[model samples]
Target: MGWTDGYIAVDWGTTNRRAYLIDGAGHCIDEFEDGMGILSVPDGGFPNAVSEIRQRLGDRPLLLAGMIGSNRGWHEAPYVPCPADIDDLVKGLVRAGDHEAIVPGVSFIGDGRADVMRGEEVQLLGAAAAGLLEPEALVCHPGTHNKWALLRQGRIHDFRTVMTGELFSLLKGHSILADLLQGEVEPNDTFKEAVRHSIAQQALPADLFAVRARVLLGQARKEDAASWTSGLLIGCDVHIGLARSSDPQVHVMGRPELTRLYATAIKEAGREAIELDGEQCFLAGIHEIARRIDG
Candidate 1:
């Protein structure tokens, strides 16, 4: 069947994949998620994976996004350079087969830096399409490799990636503070205070060491170090993301758990934080792609 009437959309990533079925009416009828990401697919197993997805979801055509289009994934989809919109993404789609195609990622090169992203583009553009974001907005998509993007007139103008989450992991599991940075990072006073200190001090390794100093001085608890570190990392991230933009609000798009922490940091930085549902944004972006294909 032609994808114009109906299709399956897969927000396929590295370690996990989420799939949705859109009916002929353009409504998402059902969805499912699993650990069958690109990395899980054995070499040359993408075709089989596609077959299984079709069997499970429907016989409709497929529109895939995320790392599934990366070099190590099924097929390396081209990168649509900024500024790009949903239509640009559609135009850059790479066909792995007649029945299915992969959505391309976005690339930004400027200011003595180059940034690239795979899966977050769909949600970023989708947030605009879904009416959850302003025409001109600063979007923060939190993850192991967090993304900060500037949306200009519903297109991705430019973006940057901060490995805050990765840094947290490295510091927690391998660094000298490994034993202290344990437990889930929560949005509490300690965290917000650390965020404030981080912004005020603008000192890194210096501010980071405060966790130990506070503990040694009996001013903080071991269980709270994770929160403080999380705050510091996210605080620095928000500071960088908001440095040039005059926007007073930040759109935090991701899982609620991560978004909550980012929202706290954003507020501590004196900016309004608005949370956007990642799944809805992903579906909206996929639908926008479908609209272009059908047009």
Candidate 2:
């Protein structure tokens, strides 16, 4: 489809939109990301936001993944059902203007329950390409709402979603955790130690006051306390997911260092840990959609 020009790939999440102008072989030539996500823009702003980016590269064809295809984006593409095949992905894709395409999210619908995801599905495809995920692998994606999916033969067999990160954000900024460090800068060790105690205790509920008690009682510290608080939150999420599933291998998705810490925690919990690059995996997902559609 191209001999003289490059293609565009985008990872459009809820809070940020990133676009890359890439050569035919997929090496990025130029890139841009701003706070123009679905939540950031007004209705009918997708075309303009995308036009701004395409104009940067002289109006090239663009493939997008993430919230650009959500109900809040340009067009609301319905989630393709789980145990979903590649054709489902191809069919669920939403097109913008003429040349820009948005990848569809995935839905797990069974047992009278329906859970959907926008950007993470693309990331999972990318994870598959990166060789970190397999058809039967159990994957954990940590984010505003963490997602765990069971894939089989390149299809999403089933999945679960947890609002772990969002809860952490709320508890930290709006609850007792916020008051514990009202005037402090950061609590590095405090955060780490909180992670340890949370893991040791096997669970942590949404008791913000208890979080303060742990610190006030000298069980934790103020410096870097955010880490400990976050660790406890993440640990609780990990523990809950583990209890609900029998999957043996755990793969952590998102920030490498954070995933590393999760991996370390998983190891301490007697499990194997694996890591995947969140951004690159999302890119691979865009390519995966391209492969299925262009084929």
Which lDDT tens digits does candidate 2 get at residues 1-295? 4422457888888898888877755567788878887798887677788778878765678887777787777777778878775567778777774677777788887867779888888777667765668766778887888887777887778888888778767876787677654443222545455556776786577434576776778865565466666767766767766664576788888867567666665655567878888877876666656655555
Which pairs in model 2 have colliding backbones? 135-151, 186-224, 187-223, 187-224, 187-225, 188-223, 188-224, 191-227, 191-228
Minimum summed lDDT over a 10-residue window in model 2 is located at 181-190
Please write out the lDDT profile of model 1 over residues 149-203, one tens digit for every residue.
9999989999999999889989998988898987878899989998898888889
lDDT of each: 0.90, 0.72
Candidate that scores best on lDDT: 1
Error of 2 at 193 (Å): 5.7
lDDT of 1 at 50: 87
CA displacement after TM-score superposition, residue 137 of candidate 2 (Å): 0.6
- Backbone collisions counted per model: 0, 9
